[model samples]
Target: MRHLFTIALVSLLLAPPAQAQNDVRFQVLGGDEALRDALIAASRLQAVTDEEDSASQDIVAAARSDYARLLAVLYEQGYFGPDISITLNGREVAGMSPFDRITQVRSAAITVEPGRAFRLGRAVIAPLAPGTDLPEGFRSGAPAGTVILRETTEAGIMGWRTQGHATADVGNQQITARHNEAELDAEITLAPGPVYRFGTLIPRGEERMRTRRVLRIAGLPTGEVYDPDEVDRAADRLRDTGVFTSVGFTEIPNPDGTLDVQAELVEAPLRRVGFGAEIQSQDGLTVSGYWLHRNLFGGAERLRFDAEISDIGAQNSGIDGFVSGLFSRPADLTPDTTLELGFRIEHLDEPTFVEDTASINIGLEHQFSDELTATAGVFARYSDVSDNFSERSVWMVGLPLGLTWDSRDNAFDAASGWYADATLTPFTAFEDGGGVRATADLRAYYGFGEEDSTRLAGRLQLGTVDGGDIAALPPDWLFYSGGSGTVRGQDHQSLGAMQNGVQTGGRSFAGASFEIRQDLFGNFGAVAFYDVGYVSEGAYGEGASDWHSGAGLGLRYDTPIGPIRLDIATPVSGDGTGEDVHLYLGIGQNF
Candidate 1:
């Protein structure tokens, strides 16, 4: 009887015989649909390429793997529980097989309910224990109920830790939902502790290169109160030296709560070489190359050599070719003096004349203080010209002496600052046709902004040349304008006095330009500007009437090299025959 019972049980267990046992299939449901949705979501997230069939196939494969994991979880959660009943489209499927059951078990639709986003309610900071050297007022004015509160708390705690308060921490802050979904109220509390003072500063590697000069530029001071902003500023100063490949600062907390600041600096390559080229629509194709030895002869001296060749195009006046040589020495050589010397050669091809010229200039610049610098220079040029109409060869010499004062915080970028510069040149005739000439130039810039990036900039320039009378002036003594740098919306060198198709006269020019710079997206910026100027022969008389004005819009790309500029300008007042719209592409701010 027992044997007979066992045989019957085994037959029943084999189960092709019972309907309930046949329903136990493990179906691979949710795999296909979940995989499809996941793939679509990933493609949207990463902007996957759909044009490639192979890429789509790969995504599908990946999605399949992901969905397999989800299906495994469902299986583990008893989707095939003891009371399992597999159905498709409301019809029962008869099976106990794993594959058929899984195929019939589809994923249930998911629904999400909207939840309120919490707003910041309050923030509280606590001071470190007594004998600590942390600065006070370190955690003040932090807005309550702000998403940034958490980040600010973390930053504050980190700041305290850097000041030798290793045990410093931020207390819990809470956010409460407001009646208005979008509005938030902020609460803040301060917990600045004792002032942390620096203990020591250590220097290493190439001591000659890490001398006082380097230390001064490094911007770290021993015995000063500890502040994160100070530490960051020091790091920035060191990096700005351009002599360090890596820089790091570490603070060690002592038993007595004092802080020891240690800085580690890695020397950059002492020597470097670079080459570059550019093609300008107006200046034509140009090639430039340069080599630099940052630490020439050691002791952090910089030596550089550069060369450039510009091919003048049809849009340019007379000048067809140019070459220049320059040398510079740092101000540390003479306490506050920086010296530079340069030589240039230019080829001029006018409609009626061809000329070759060479010039040499020497300049001495001295920084009276951090906010004031003075420059004085002397330049001499010799030119040989063949008159097109006169059919005569003419030789002339020119000498210019000038002084400049620059106090602007940023030479290339000034949003809320003021700078003024003036130059004077007195000329003497050295040849038969030579006559006395004098020229004066002045410029000023003013900025108005609470910060450096957002501000209004105003600029003014005035230039005048006099040689007793207009006709007595040398051709080279006259002022010329018309380009993005001068009066836009016109041709290059197409302004000033003209006589018989040549600028044989001298004139005075006065102009003012205003620009408002606003930050746009990321590193990009936008600028709107208006420039007004006039060129006249008479110094201040009614006859000095030729004046023109232009307005323009510009886009600035803050590139690593400089700010790349694209400007479109229209002549507000002009002859109207010139190009109505002028476009410019170049590096650096226009000022």
Candidate 2:
């Protein structure tokens, strides 16, 4: 019974006080508006007093703590000497006992006297590594801001670490304030441990994945000078494979002066499935889905199968579809290289042509960096095509090479940076002889305004089939310049080159699109865009061509995954420019 009584008493003292109203006032007598705001933001009493449930005890506790907190804030702002006081209900809060129980906070007042700001009389950091760039304010005669001292010390330590001093740290700090002269002197010393080399990478928490594969993918340069960046990159590589939900690295120093890094990983589920759909009023609806296996053989190999069906309920084009499968193995030849094998079968039914095609490709992709990659492949294709001009069976073999640079902030709806993809394929067709197909798609985005509320995006697309007979090439290999992808507000495949009074896919194509987007209320945004496309009878815009353009307005509703897009467009220029409007709906930005 006595123990129970003691427990109850302790619980009462520790329990939160009952709800009460508070009126808090904070003033800075010798500071500017910025300093005053900072001090207020740093005050715990000011924060709690704004809450309706703040009790007298809570207010008193917060007020007492505010003394040190406010002083620290002032020092960070170059004020070394400060006086702070807080009063609650006409009583000094600091004088209140911890067990004092009060019913209501009622009112509290805070005052701060910030003395003269201090400038750096002597600022020195010893043994900085070569090429270290410290903060500009960490110099004599500059404001002796406390943050500057921290920045200087951190820079000094980081500089040593970058030079393979894995254990670099701040050894000591000496600070002095001469109150009479309003000056401060700060000295920092760094400890640069012995330079070390990288040992081996140890995998941890990995299930089902091969440990050897993990080490291969990480590509930690064992026996080389230790680099923090390399460790980070190794972790990134594992994450990019999509086999890991989380990846982190820990460093352990060995007696022989080498650092053994451990990769801590959490494996993601092996299988994933996704579906998407898009629609154009004239071209019809398209739906696609994919099934993926992230670790096909416990070696971070990825296998994916995709299928798409299109032209549903279309007014013009016939139904079209494709099925494809891809297999990729990471760390194939080198740590940054990946081997890819793909197979695709496609059927196209357009007003101008109907074709059936099958293709197989083997390729390698090398990552130069996070934003750049290069690919080379060999492919074989078989096609049976029928058009107004001819019906033919064609076989082709090609070497395809590609380079991609992607720095876009977002792939689905980019707000800044640029994306460029260029592909060149040299093929030998049984009917059309040898030829080369080249295409480049470049896009750029710029964002301004607060929180990037306004953005401007642009895209340029160029394609050409050179050194081939236009009539004998696979129909799908040719270019058509009408549809939601080219110029909206026009019928699918409406614009093509004319040969012997028959409209056919062009040998060359060019398209440009520009948009100005503005974020509206909530998750909604508005866009105005213009698109222009040109199709030519010969390669590289060398022959006769026609240009068509469209202008449109769009609306976007943002979601967790991506933005849903709705666009209304009409032909603005060209032979068929008219008031006919077209509508498009999709899950992502048009580009």
Candidate 3:
């Protein structure tokens, strides 16, 4: 449509001038406010309005182009009949002969008198399949817009395609404009080919991956009715497996009412290595690295190894180290399920205690659907932990079960949707006793206004360990709130159970946070948030009810990976010395 207007403008712009002139201006005269504004917006004259030394021919060309664009826009807006005139300086475009020459030009004018808008006089679409989704404006007596008419045609074809018809399209279309009655008559015919079922899938670009596995991963249900959504999903599954850098699927025409599927794949690099580092006010320097093998054991299985070391600042000496190895087998028992195996080792020396642990777990994660997943596993751990008051070594075995429901549109900047997760782990201390640990977390997000620029996000977490001795358990198993992950105004794990003037992880924990986010200009945005947390040595009860709160403001810069956050908060109320403010830096939202 725009190209058509440009062509018209080129023909209208015929300037016989000797010298070039600048200082172009634009004006919209005589039309309805909305229509006149639309024409002005459609005009291209304003693009070169600041060209002070433009040639006379340039100004004339600009005006002519503006007139052409304005006319198209007027018609598309349902105004088939409109009076349009383009004037350069004081000379009318029609009055200037082909031989007339100009030396200088200053002003340009576009006058549009858009008449009454045309309505849909007689709208008819033949062979429109039942349940076809269409625009409301495509009906008779509604405003006749060119865009709407095109959308109506597309909707009709899509309707047939949804009902197993793979080759459905608009066979013919006729749109007649009537200037006498200010109306438009539209007629469309559609052709839907025979219903198609799924056929055999042929694979290509399979260098490292086996063709049979590729077909299995695609998981296309053969003999089922054809659906474009299904084809797209199969391709998406191939892409999400991490084994493929690129994936494509094409439909081949076949006989017997079936569409043959052709799969094209690009295998990702077999091995990858990367590293990262971060610095914080309280935690010093943290460095980390990882290695990955996408097709470790074939069948799109992944193997990974990672290591991290932290607390390396000049002033701080409480350093920590961690290492882990992970493996996952895709499509283990079901297409959307995976078998995962993991082993981890960590050494921690904090203000509260010194702790070391080695843990291993084997789990099966089944994706029930796009929004939900369930994981069940058995884990074993051996840990030696000591604090100022006590020290202990323990061996523990546990059964872990977890479920998560996530509907957030974007992980970094979620404007709408809710997420919830729950985990229950029952453990037996080999030489001491037995206990049960349970936790549930809920997060919700909602946006207001256009494009969801303003959003409200919130989270609530609850946890408890019922029978284990708090001093004997692994430090990581216990909960402590106060950090970028929880209340930001306080130091890391600074608001936990107090023992002999030192902070210690608690068996019972609760934390909640709320944020109001508003995007500013470009990639910048601002947020106001409040967070509260409670931790105690005993399970959640009256005696364990010491809650600390923090309220503050934050700034965020959006990135493809996530949002970079800088939250500066002050303790609203809690175990703090006077008014201590803290600044926390990280990626992604606080949650």
Candidate 4:
């Protein structure tokens, strides 16, 4: 009884304090105008939306205090004055009025003073030693504009380092103003301090894999000058070995102005399996799979197997089956010679059309140097086709020879430079009807800017397939265009010489395209392109005189897999059929 009485007395004492806290509530008056003024002063608000049912009334009290603090801030910032008033039940709230009111406002603008343009007043080059050849274009008396400054200053210094002067530097000497408002004068100086030569060639981590063949392919010499391009090439050559996960080169500069380049390597998994699926606007759906073994026989040999199935988007859909085998050796079978064997089988069906082909090829590849590779292969093919227009089978054999010169520093992310490859197939076929099929393809790219993000890539392809009558030719041997790879405004395999909406076979076809890619907004990019192509019955004949040209704009999204491309093209010249637009969704650049 005594404890219970004590408890009752304590509860009685705390009851009043709790009740007073619960009754603590204020009504906020003035509508949107007051809220706006409060927001302008405080920039943020802390209001309780669920306070109506909250058991803890402390939150509501805190919210009211925050509101009152905002009002106080407004008064201190002079946003409120006598014109703005706060009253409760016809009584003004003390200390709730602004100190001052806003009046007139003003803005700031930029103004440029008239002056002469900047010009190159003089140029001088200081070589590390006498008799060092300074390349042309790095001279004084040249213009001092941004363009000239870049070519003579930045590019010049880089060029000197590429040649052997690894410690080269450039500085502006003097500045003078001319009378013209757009003209100024300046002097440029260059210091090619010292020429650095390559040190010992050391292969780290994967010495056994970096055989003589790989070193030869890298094209890096111990006595040669230290060049960034050469280092990059060596890295690429090592990667091509297919034996390493990652390969890179680092240059360590010496106090004597010499640089020691180190080639670092990491071993990679020799065997891999990959699978992917794609959906296309034109091709509809495709599923692909591949299996690769880099060291098939443990001597840096490679073997790959690939399979793909596609459903073309059209009234007439087709299924294609392909099986291929490729075998190669790293070393020259006979000094300076390499050997390759290839075989393929294909089957296709579209509506009432069906075709089957089998081919076998053998080739010899010879590498004269790191930049040049030549291959000559002989192949025999048997093709059979059955369609509404014709049903025929033919066997043909030919020898194709090709040469490739790749000097580009990067294959996947090239910022500058170019590469070229040319192939020619010339021979007679012993089939139903025989003729020559020849093709040539060329591509180039050039990068601008310090980061090499701005680039221009161009391509040209010319081919001729002449044999038998048009009706007697195999369906697979015919040439077709009009797609993301050709003209974007046209349909896949639908562009060629046509007669009354029907394909009239042509003996030759030629195409050329150029694209300029500019990086914008981080990983996003924009592209402008032009394409032209024509098909002819004979070489340079009037029958093929009608050529079509197209121009378009594209947006690119750089993704981890590659570049996602979206293109919209319009036919610029041809039969006036209004305007045609095509949207392409694919990976990598169009080129």
List per-prediction Cα lDDT, in the order shown: 0.53, 0.90, 0.80, 0.60
Candidate 1 whole-model C-alpha lDDT, 0 to 1: 0.53
| Model 2 spans > 4 angstroms off | 1-95, 107-119, 143-146, 177-183, 575-578
Off by over 4 Å in 3: 1-77, 82-114, 124-133, 136-138, 271-273, 313-317, 449-451, 498-503, 536-543
TM-scores of all candidate predictions against the true structure: 0.53, 0.89, 0.82, 0.58
Q: What's the distance in Å from true for residue 336, model 2? A: 0.4
> In every candidate, how many clashes are there?
24, 0, 5, 10
Model 4 C-alpha lDDT versus the unseen true structure: 0.60
- List model 2 lDDT by residue over 1-591, tens digit each: 999989978876777764644557777889799999888888888788778776656677778889889889999999998877788777777787776666666567888889899999989999989999999988889988889998889889889988999999988889999999999999888899999899989999999899999999999999999888898889988998999999989999898999999888999999999999998888889999999999999999999999999999888879999999999999999889999999999999998999999999999999999999999999999999999878999999999999999999989888999999999999999866888999999999999998899999999999999887667888888888878888887778888898556789888999999999999999999999999999998888877789899999999999988999999999999755786888999998898
Error of 3 at 92 (Å): 9.0
Superpose all Cα atoms of candidate 2 onto the true structure and report the RMSD in Å to 1 decimal.
Answer: 3.4
**lDDT for each residue of candidate 3 in 1-591, tens digit (9 for 90 to 100):** 999979866754763442333333444444467766676677776555545556666656676677678878877788888777777767787677865545556556656677778999999997978887788888889998787887888888888888989889888888898999989999998989889999988888988887777788778888999988788878877887899988888887587888889988889889999876655666667789999999876688889999999876613238899999999987777667789999999998876778899999999998777789999999999989887657888899999999999999987789999899999999998866889999999999999987899999999999988886655667777778876678877667776675334467777899999999999999999999999998876776324446788888999999887898887788888866347777767677887
List, residue by residue over 357-414, the lDDT tens digit for candidate 1: 7778877776554455666666777766554334333334445544455566666765
| Candidate 4 residue-wise lDDT, 350-460, digit = tens | 544578989899999987667788999899888787855567876778888898887767666455656677777764545455666677777888999858778988888
Which runs in model 1 stand beyond 4 Å of their true positions? Answer: 1-114, 117-148, 151-194, 198-200, 203-213, 224-230, 252-261, 266-286, 320-478, 498-507, 511-533, 538-543, 548-591
Steric clash pairs (candidate 3): 20-55, 21-54, 21-55, 21-56, 22-54
Top-down lDDT ranking: 2, 3, 4, 1
- CA RMSD per model (angstroms): 13.0, 3.4, 6.0, 15.1
Error of 2 at 507 (Å): 2.2
